[model samples]
Target chain A: MVILFPSKPSILACGAVAGPVERKSVFYSFFDSVIEDERWGQKTNEQGHSQMIQEACDILMKKAEINNLDVDFFLSGDLVNQMTPTNFAARELAISFIGLFSACATSISSVIIASLLTELGASELAIAGASSQHNAIERQFRYPIDYGAQKPATSQWTVTAAGYALVGKHNPEYPSIIAGTVGKVVDYGEVSPFHMGGAMAPAAYDTITSHLKKRHQKITDYDLIMTGDLGKIGLKILKAMFAQSGAKQEELDVLRDAGAEFYGDDKAFQAGASGAGCSASVFFSYIEQQLKIGRYKKVLLVATGALLSPMSFQQGETIPCTAHAIEITME
Target chain B: MDPQEYQQLEQQMTPPTPYLKNVLKAFFVGGIICTIGQAITYLYVIFFNFTEQTAGNATVATMVFIAMILTGLGLYRKLGQFAGAGSAVPVTGFGNAVISAAIEGRTEGFVLGVGSNMFKLAGSVILFGVASAFFVALIKLILVSVGVLEW
Candidate 1:
């Protein structure tokens, strides 16, 4: 469903923190901080995941010049089991917490909810975003990190990062969220857990197309439409689907994927970076910075997620995917 | 599009697995591992009072011990990635699998975690190995009774 925000909730500040490996990311400089240790000095990967989220939220609050007491709600999620990392973070932040799970799409989904709260005049300031830890998430969803299982080229590397945006009353000087689309679960019968992008591409296409049709806007209306983590092959599949639908070449040029281009053609990353933090970090830091500086006047941030658990995949169930999109425009 | 049509399209779009390259890697890596085992066997025969038959057990144990060290040091996984089935098909791979599972389950604690999960990946190998060994021994016994084979 497309939800129009007449109040135009503004992203007052954004904070993105990533792990040591993320220094190689193309948008590394845009991140607020890159922790040298993946575990952030924590005893376990999950604790480290929580630490990263806390650090990101701290940075966001610092940037916004607000304390935890000033914030009304904390909306967040992660790919870990029960989103325990985010839940732990919320406990530390001492904010009214609403834990969400749209898989990787939690980044945009959380923001959409924050915007709704802002529009309803129920929230003066809210922290919204998502996070993912490579070791923690990989161990949960795939194999143990030390397992020597050879992954296919379609596989994506989960990033250890957290991105949070402080959402508040509209300010013309900031990038304001004007609308959002809460995606329906779309399944194209994709079964391979290794090829997440292929499974999520169809859902992304569905959400974007529906958003455009319902909003009565053309593809060219936005400066960019970036999907969350449809890796190299998934982006190609999405483009192919669009091309077959008779989309013009120039119109398709605006399409981009945070996952496909994250590592800048590094073969070691295979299809590219993924995880809940993949889009969160990119959107809250790089994308938000671009909008604030007028580099991009309007853009659609579509975070797609493959909604399959380890049990579901093991039971021979196809991946059901979803994409949540928020349209950000600078005055 | 329908699921079948989309699946077909997805198949067309997805790249084919590089079988030739992977097979070549697997072959060389597997060969090197076997070469190392042979060297270890020779060392056992020369330095100790072990016969060739006795050295086989020592060599297997030594290989598994080395693999356990590599697994603890977090180096075997990288080798496994590079060598594919080469690292996995060997006895070293079995050791690595067991140790990795043990390490991964450490977060949950010792008895329930490490003890229960230590054999998660390698338990099948042991079960099938013993079962097949028993069946083969049974077949030989049957043939010997019929005077078709000698024990």
Candidate 2:
């Protein structure tokens, strides 16, 4: 079921921070802070993940003209195991914290939970954010930084970035979060590690169809229906799934994957960017820009995540996945 | 879906991997690595007065040591990216795999980090190697007893 916000919370401010690599991407203009140092001047890549979160949160607070004490809660997550980086960052920030894990779909997941909290009168102001580092994720999930192992063409490079959105009472100047749809874990018993797009496409399709059905809306109702980190292959699979379900070609045209959008024509990114930061960076930056400029009135940001562990993949278990969609409309 | 049905869906949904290109890269890189090993063996034989057989063993050891150093310096990942399976299927690749895990666990401190995690990736390779060797030796023993083979 789609959770409709009666008190529609406005995204007053957002902060998008990325590593030096993103500066090479087209979305460079959308970021508020781009640290050239991959380590963020930290001793390790794991430490850098926490530093990015803290910086992103600080930037969001500064943009919203609010202090740490003024915020009611901080909802954040990262791709790191146990989400220790987010936990450490919260320790430094000392705000009421809720650590979430939806793999790459975390940005929208956190936003949905935060917005729900605010709409239900549980929080006055809540911040939702996520961060991921290329090196840190590679080391933890696959091989170490030194393995020098070859990556398949379908392997998505993790985007080293963090994104934050501040949700509170509706404001005329900001885009309002009108609704959110929580996703179910859909696993078609896909076990391929390199083919994340295929593994996650089913869940994206499931969530998108459910959200549209619940709201009695057609695909044409939204200007853009974006999925988080489905990459190139995943997008094709999602479209095919929709087509088989009798969705028109024109209707499927609005579907765009955030990972594909950010790394367009960048051969170095193989498939695309995959991580919690993928949606966080793209939404808080590119999508937010289009909304602010009135280019798109209604947008469905569906963040997808492949809930797989290296141990599980090695143990012959299929990858389970989930996708969460948030409806943003500018009045 | 059942495993068989899911497998069919995966086959239909997944795109075809460029196997030819990967094979070419691996072949080229693997050849280069073997050529380097040969060169090291000759050097040991010619300059150190060692026999070819002993030099060959030393060459393997040297390559593994160098691979470990490259892993620590974070240069092996780049090689792996370019060479694909070529960098991974060799003895040196095994060294890189073990050292990489050890280094990754370094931040958590010695016992829990480096010591425990050093074999995360390479431990299986070692297990398989020993198991296969045992099987091969058992076969050799059976052949000798049956008078079908001579040592």
Candidate 3:
């Protein structure tokens, strides 16, 4: 369902941090920091995952010129079991925490909740976002990090990164959230976990089409309609779906995916980047910067997530996917 | 669209797997691993007074040890990705699986983590290997007992 924020809660500031391997990302310059070590000098990957989240929150607070006590809530999640990394970071930040789990869409989902809080005058300032670490997430979802398992071309590389955005009262100068859509779980009977994009494309299509229909807006009304982590093939499938619905070629041209173009045609990443952090880092950094620079006047950020646990996948269940979207306008 | 129709459309849109290319890569990489094993067997025969039959055990052990080292060094995973089943079908792949699981479980602690998880991936291989071997030997014994096969 689409929720209109009459108050138009603004994203006051954003902070994005990535691991060592993400230095090669096309939008690397947009990131606030890229640590030289994937572990971030932590003893374990989980510790490093927590460190990455803490670093992102710290940077967000620093950018907004606010301390942890000034923030009302800390909303975040990751792919780790029970989201321990985010939980640990929340403990350190000491902000009233509400951990969310919309899978990869947690970035936007958290922001949506924070925006709702801001609209209701319940929160003055809140930290909201998501994160993922490759080693930590991979070991849980698939195989051990050092295990020699052959992945299909449809498989996506889980990135190690964290992104947090500071949401507060609306400011005319910043990108303000006007409307948000909390997506429904859409399952098209896609069984292969390797082909996540195929499973999630229908959910994204459903959410975007319904969001536009509800808001009485056309696809061309926004400067961009970017999906979170639908890799190269997923993006193609999304486009095809739109085409089948009689969307014009030019209208479809505005569609883009953060994961598809993340590594800039590096075949090593296979289909493209995945994980919770993929959308979080790109949205809070690159897309936010683009809005600030007037490169995009209005945009729709739809973060899609495959909601399947390792146990569910092993039990021969199909992947149920969801996509959460927020319409942001720069005035 | 219905799920069945959507699945068909998705299948149409997705690229076909490069089976021929993958098979070629697997063949070459598997051959290279076997060639290395043969070289180790020859070395055992020439310098260690090991016959062809006796050298088999030593070569297998040596290959697994080398794979364990490569896995710890974080290089075997890359090779596995590049070569697909080529790097996996060999005994070295078994070594990589066990060692990798052990290394992965290090974060959880020693007893419950590394020790128990060391066999997480390879346990199936061992179970099936022993079971099949026992069944095959049982069939042979039955045949020999009935004079249907030579002992």
Supply DockQ values for each candidate.
0.71, 0.57, 0.81
Cα lDDT of model 1 by residue, A207-273, tens digit: 9999999999988999999999999889988988888788999888989999998888898898999
> lDDT tens digits, residues A265-298, model 3?
8998999999999999999999999999999999
| DockQ-based ranking | 3, 1, 2
lDDT for position A153 in model 2: 67
lDDT tens string, model 2, A1-331? Answer: 6899978898888999999888776788889999989889998788998999999999999998998999999998998889988999999988999999999999999999999998889888999978899889988788777877777767788899999999898887889999999999998877778888878988998899999999999999999999999888778778877877788988999999888767777887888888899889889978888899999999999999999999999899989999999999998
Residue pairs in collision within model 1 = none
lDDT tens digits by residue: candidate 3, B53-99: 99999999999999999999999999999899999999999999999
| Model 3 Cα shift for residue A189 (angstroms) | 1.3
TM-score of chain A of each: 0.99, 0.98, 0.99
Residue B28 C-alpha lDDT in model 1: 98
Complex DockQ, candidate 1: 0.71
Q: Candidate 2, overall lDDT?
A: 0.88
Candidate 1 C-alpha error for residue B97, in Å: 0.8
Give interface RMSD for all predictions: 1.2, 2.6, 1.0
Ranking of predictions according to lDDT = 3, 1, 2
TM-scores, one per candidate:
0.97, 0.95, 0.98
